[model samples]
Structure formats: structure tokens, C-alpha cells
Target: MRQLWRFGLEQAKSCIFAVVIFSALAITQFIEISFIHRYDFILIICLLTQLLMLTSKLETWDELKVICVFHLIGLALEIYKVHMGSWSYPEEAMSKVFGVPLYSGFMYASVASYLCQAWRRMDVQLMKWPPTWTVAILSAAIYFNFFTHHYIYDFRWIFKAATILLFFQTIVYFKVNQRTYKMPVVLSFALIGFFIWIAENIATFFGAWQYPGQSETWEIVHFSKISSWLLLVIVSFLIVAMLKHIKGKDNGNYV
Candidate 1:
């Protein structure tokens, strides 16, 4: 147990700024729950814990790009989705619980960081980008999506996949070398997408929420497989393009 706590503490050191921000919000949420509203206390606690996790500094510089782009694309996509009533989560959670509204940012923080840690557990080097083999494996993963639970509920998987390819093509123009495809760096974003996909599937399957069943077909797993590639590719852009720009290290920052 001591070892576990130590490991966890080491992990939470990167996003201290995010944690501080979220903890402040969490206190407000706590007050709202205790004095004003009768909400899901369990879910609120989960949200608070996630926010606390932001105090952890993540040194995955490569993943900075993944977080930046995924947050933009996922936020855009989620806004559109919520607008369309494609699905919904409780809206009263004060926009800060990692589920609806701005808590989405917390969810975004979890993506690349979670993936980086998980990939380290895999103990293998990731293949270089734009290589024939990488493309081949990515293609196979795409194929796997179409046959699974992902597409059954959300076609956004298609959008995710397309963005990944675009991100990769953009990277190709830079002539990125083999070492750029480091394992944790690439997996940082990929794992986040996968977790979102998995959570959505589990929730829908259990009737936590339901997408309109009137859709013409329900192709979940097989549908989302290939689109998974977009995540890794998009991360490349986030690290290679977005973060550099954000940090004033790129030509695009001025624009």
C-alpha cells in the first residue's frame, strides 16, 4: 500500500497547475452539493479525485501536443454532439466534473498521461510514423473498430480516425525520423481515445445512457478500429505543431 501511494504521488506531480485549478472548483462543487443541490455525491467525489490528479507533473513533452489537439477536436466534437442530442450527461454538475461541460478538460488531461503510463507497462518501442509497417498496423486497428462496439453508438470515431491520418500526413511533410515514434509519447493520446470509447460503450450497453436506436445500423467495434489511428497521428500534430505554437516556439503562433 505504501508503494502504491508513492507510485501514485510520483505520477500526480506534473499537472499541479491543473490540480490547483480543479481543487478550487471542487471546493465550490462540494459546497454546492452540501448546501444547495442534491447531486450524485459519488460521481462528485470521482470528479474531485480526478482534479487532484492534475497536480501531477507529466514530463511527457511529446504528449503535450496530444493533449492540445485532442482537447480541441474532442471539445468541438462533443459540443456538436451535445447540441445534436446524440447523447447527454447530467448538465447540473457545474461544468467541472470531468464528464459534462468543462469537466471535459479534466478528461482531456487524462488522455495522453494515462496512455503514456499504460504504454510503459507494455514494455515495447512504438513503430516509427509513416513507415509502411506502422501504416499497416494502424490499418489493421481501423479494421478492428468497424467490427466492434464503438461505431454502434458514435460515428465520431470516423472523424477521429480521419484527423489522425491528416495529422500523420502533416508530420510526413516534416520528415520526422524513426525516434519520433516513441512508445509513451504516441500512446499518450491513443489510450485516452480508447478509454473514452470503452467508457461510452460500457455506459450505453448498461443503459446508463442510450443513443437513439433508430439509427440505420449498429456497428460498434468493427467500425471504430481504423479510426483509432487518428489519435496517434493527431498527437504528433499536438506535440509537433500545437504545443510549439502555444509555447511561442513556432511560426504558427503569431497567426
Candidate 2:
């Protein structure tokens, strides 16, 4: 019983930031402020939330750096995606740059924050982690595909195959209470991707962003998006793994 309580507590610790961000989004959907754009308000709330986390020691400096990097990465992708007509931000904001709001980057950073917090709180470890270079190459290919698919053939399935080849044997070890739990790394990616897809639906419902099809009315995001999120989860996982130096052997064993 005590162990379960500790497990729940640690899970909450890991999720608190994401919960707060989602809560803020949910609440802001109903709020009307004539003086300020909703996007700018979200940006302010996100920045303040981040500062509060840092000041309270809920997040460490190293994790902050990782989160910041994701923010930039996400912002770059947002700019390109928005330009490519992949998604649309309907609201106006002073914080907008090339039609991408600053707060949009925080959405990506939130993923990093969640992984970092969970890694530390749950004492995660990797087993048979694929070589960094291999994953890096895969990540680059996946990212490039997002942009090139519009002009060229969509080779996402091929990229997904390569990712499976590279990470199929990898395993992740995390703790629940005093006990350690293990899962295939690929499975972890799929699980996180699934949840992120769900969150994307919720976010879209709240008007965080919209697909071309959603310009007139909100609809459930296509289930096919889970594949994209799976690839992204790998990218985020690699970043966190690199930062933590949790490399493992090629065989399904920890070094």
C-alpha cells in the first residue's frame, strides 16, 4: 500500500507540469479578454508557469536547457509546417512570428519537460539502447520527411521501418515505488505517441491550432497522426537519452 502511494506520488510529480499547462489551456478557452489576444495570454501563462517551476526547484537547470532546445526545435518545425499549410493558427497575437506563436514552442518543450521529470523521478534506465549515431540519423530522416513529403514521395513507412530495425531490441527500465519496471523502447514510444495524439485532439478542441479541415469546425484529429507522434517520441527520447548518457549494449542487456 505504501509502495503504491509512493508510486502515485512520483507519477504526480512527473505529470504536474503537463497537468498545469493543460489546465491553463482548458480554462483560457472560456476566458474573454478584449485587451489582449488569447495567444499572447497563453504565452504569458506558459512563461510564468515555467518560471514558477524553476524557482520552486520542480525542474533542474539541465532539464531547462533540454526543454529550451526542444522549444527552438518545435518553433522551427511550426514555422515550416504553418508555411507549408500543414496546420493553421487562427488567433492573433503580438507573440506571433511568421504566424507561429511563441507559446507553440512551449508545447514541444512540454514533452521534454515531461520526459526529464519522469526520468529523474522514476529513476529510468535504458537497456540495449541503440547507438546514438544510428538514432540521430533516423531522427534526421524522419524530420526531413515531414517537409519533403509535400514535394516528393512520402517515405514515412520506410523511415518507420528503419526506426524499428534500430530500436526493436531496446528496453527501458523505470521504477514504480521501490520496484523497477521494464518495457520495450518501441512500446514506450508507441504508448507515449498514443497519449500525445489524444492530447493533440484535446488541444485542437480548445483551438490551440487547427488542421485545414478543421478551419470551419473542430473534428477529431486523424488517428494516422499517431505514427508521426511515434517518430517524434523517438526524437525526444534520443535527446533525453543523450543528455542522461544512458547508452547500453547492442544486445538486449544493460552495460
Candidate 3:
């Protein structure tokens, strides 16, 4: 029970960035400020949060680089998805480009931040990680599918299957207190995706963005979105894992 409590504490610590962002979403939802657009205000809040984390040593420079990469990747997707009418930012914001608020990218960055912080806090390691080439190809395919699905037949289920086949033998090891725990890599992806889905519900309730059905009357986000988050979480995890692998190799402590 003690280890479980410690594990929860570490997870919460790792989620500081996301928590702050969510808090901003909730606060801005009800508050009225004439000088700054809500989206821009949220963006400023995100930037300040990032700076604070960096200055406080809660996030390293290297991890920030990774977060930046995810931010760009996510922003590009947001632009395309909004264009395709997948979802939208209904509010007016000066920082919007092609109808997507710039702050939307930070939503994705928060996921990367959590993964990096949790990896460090829990002393995470991987076992039987797949080859670099295979992982890279899969990651590219998963990302590509996100865009192509709007035009072509969706291959998400196929990619999910591929992910399972590729990582079925792999395990994730994380420490809590004095003991280490192991989980199937695929299961971890599903669990993280589930939690993100819950967060999405909260964000939508707070008016972060609106799905087509949510524009008029807010309802529970479709459960199918969980599969999408699962795939996205897989990509995020693989990128972070590869970075860790490369760093481990450099330090002669390959994970």
C-alpha cells in the first residue's frame, strides 16, 4: 500500500505540466478578461509553465527539446485536422493559424512532458525493445495514417495490430519505492490512452475545443476516440523510448 501511494505521488508529480494546463483551461472557461484572448492567455500560461519547470530543474533541456518536437508535430496535425473538419477551436483568438489556436500544440506537448518526467521519476527501463528500424517505420506509418485517413481508407486498426505484434514481447519496468514493477508495453499504452481519454472529456467540458456534436450540446466524447489516443500515445512513447535508448548507449548503460 505504501508503494502504491508512492507510485501515485510520482505519477502526479510527473503530470504537473498537464495539471497546470488543465487548470488554466478550467480557470479561463469561467473568467472574463478583455485585454487577452482566452486562447492566447492559455498559451502564455503554458509558456510560463514551461519556463518555470525549466528554471526549477523539474524538466531538463534535453526533455524540453523532445517536448518541442512533439509540439510541432501536434500543431501540424491540428492544422490539418481542423481543415478537414475533424474538430475546431470555436473561440476567437489572435494566435490562431488556419483556425487552430497555437496553444493547441501545447496540449500534445503536455503528454510528452508527462512521459519524460514519469520516466525519470520512476526510473523506467525497457526490456526486449524492438529494433530501431522497425520502430521508426512503425512510428512513421502511425503518424502518416493520422493525415491520410481523412482521404484514404483508415488503417488505424491495422497499425494497432502491428503495434501489438511488434511489442508483444517487450516489457516496461518502473520502480516504486524499493521495489520494481513490470507491465506489458502494449497494456501501458492502453492505460495511458484511457487516462488521456478521461482528460479529453474534462477538457471538452471546460470548452477546450469542440467536436461536431459538442458545438451545440456537450456530450460524452465517443469511446472510439480512445483508439485514436492509444495510437498517439504509442507514437509518443516510442519517440521517448528511442531517445532514451540513444542516450543510454552514449552513457554505456543501454536500457
- Using Cα atoms with residue i matched to residue i, what is each candidate's TM-score against the true structure? 0.40, 0.92, 0.99
For each candidate, the alpha-carbon lDDT, in order, equals 0.43, 0.86, 0.96
Worst 10 residues of 1 by lDDT: 171-180
Best by lDDT: 3
Judged by whole-model lDDT over C-alpha atoms, candidate 1 comes out at 0.43
For model 2, residues 1-255, the per-residue Cα lDDT tens digits are 887888778867877767767777788898888888888988888999899999999999989999999999899999999999899898889999999999999998999998999888888888787777887778778877888889999988898788788888888998886699888888888888999999999999988999999998899999999988987888898878876763333445343
Ranking by TM-score: 3, 2, 1
lDDT score for residue 66 of model 1: 59
Which digits, one per residue and each the tens of the lDDT, describe model 3 over residues 30-63? 9988999999999999999999999999999999
Per-residue lDDT over 14-69 for candidate 1, one digit per residue giving the tens place of the 0 to 100 score: 33434443444446444554543323443354355544443443335455445555
Top of the candidates by TM-score: 3
Candidate 3 has a TM-score of 0.99
Cα lDDT of candidate 3 equals 0.96
lDDT of 2 at 81: 98
